[model samples]
Target: MVRVATLLLLRHGRTTANADGGLAGRQPVELDETGRAQATAVGERLRSVPLAAVVTSPLIRCRQTLDLALPQAEPVVAEGLIECGYGSWEGQPLKKLAKEPLWPVVQQHPSAAVFPEGESMAAMSARAVAAVRAWDARITAEHGPEAVWLACSHGDVIKAIVADALGVHLDLFQRIVVDPASVTAIRYTPLRPFLVRLNDTGGDLSGLVPPPRKRRRRAARTTDSDAAVGGGAGAAR
Candidate 1:
């Protein structure tokens, strides 16, 4: 069984559309002042970690977020990580969209929700999950299993990725909340992917780093991919 790299899913900060209560959906919406601040704050929190790679959605908002958050890193744009296509719904107010007949299906039955002349919610989840897993494997192979990477994406995309890691059904993904600028961490093993952190807005990230090579080798001998019997002692400080 091959060890996989840790994936850091970062939802882009709030955009102008978000502030105005509209759905940005694949629009070229940029970040607002508050969003820039959020990106800066998250950057400070991640400044110390040595990230092996940085990937981002092709959306402008996501690129803007990564610009402010990790300006020193070169992030690759992944089409699979882009926002879900909302078609005619793009740029519409959330309040107005909620009144549409399709809204209920989106909230309660996302697996079956397909936008008018746009992509299906299930399709979005599938592509996002596939992109993340493929990247994780590639990073692990190239940079070793201890590699840590980041992916800047939209809220729904991150939520879908998180749901997949948790083994939750796509229909129930609405229950997951991925706040703007929040970071979610997942570690994939041969057996399963572990959700280490979820919706973390302002948390110490030093704990996410793996132990030294010698210590890691020793720890590997004592533990498998299986979860701790009773939530075993957390990551090494």
Candidate 2:
């Protein structure tokens, strides 16, 4: 049987930059008050899932979100899952950046757009996908084929990973929407990957839980007279 694993991609909760409408990029900004509540709510939403591992981006905002959402799990920092480096645009107002010519390319043709003094969208997608796949393999090997894992990362990073899982081109990745403190599930199998859920914030996930193992029924013991009858029938045959 092909081993299968489920990856729960969670976007970090709202941050100060998010509230201020600024691009946080890789800044060390922490989650805001409302973000804390959102984190707690999402944590409660996923309480039923038995996560094998909780992975997170190296960014402080993501780390904080992971801690708040899954307090018991020690988050494993995946450097490759960090947010896209916005470089010069870091901490800038989104409204101003929206007017720039490069912004259109970023939205429509992300495959060809490059952040000034930073990284390209394609590079970000490559690294994020690789990191997710690596963790999927590790979790499945360690926890079994039905293992479920959580990866707490940024919005753009999660979008990139989702785009790859859906086999969508990097240029079209902007069409995908990932909100703060949302959960998206992707199940990886040897044959093909399945997108179980996307941007789910208020849905019950009891269906995602693995079904209970079936109990094997023991064969009834045959009495001596019954065995003798069976032997006589066999001799007659």
Query: On residues 1-237, what C-alpha lDDT tens digit does candidate 2 reach at each position?
Result: 244778999999999999999999998999999999999999998898998888889999888887888889899889999999988999899999999889989988999989998999889999999999988998889998768899999898988888887878888788889999999998776655667789998888656655543444566443221323543442111
CA error at residue 170 for candidate 2, angstroms: 1.1
Residue 24 error, candidate 1, Å: 0.4
Each prediction's whole-model lDDT (CA): 0.90, 0.84
Model 1 per-residue lDDT tens digits across residues 157-205:
9889989989999888889899999999999888888999999999999
Provide C-alpha RMSD values for all models, in order. 1.9, 12.0
Q: Please list the residue runs of candidate 1 whose C-alpha ends up more than 4 Å from where it truly belongs after superposition.
A: 215-224
Model 1 lDDT, full chain set: 0.90
Model 1 clash pairs are none
Question: Model 2 segments beyond 4 Å from truth?
Answer: 212-237
The TM-score values for the models, in the order shown, are: 0.95, 0.88
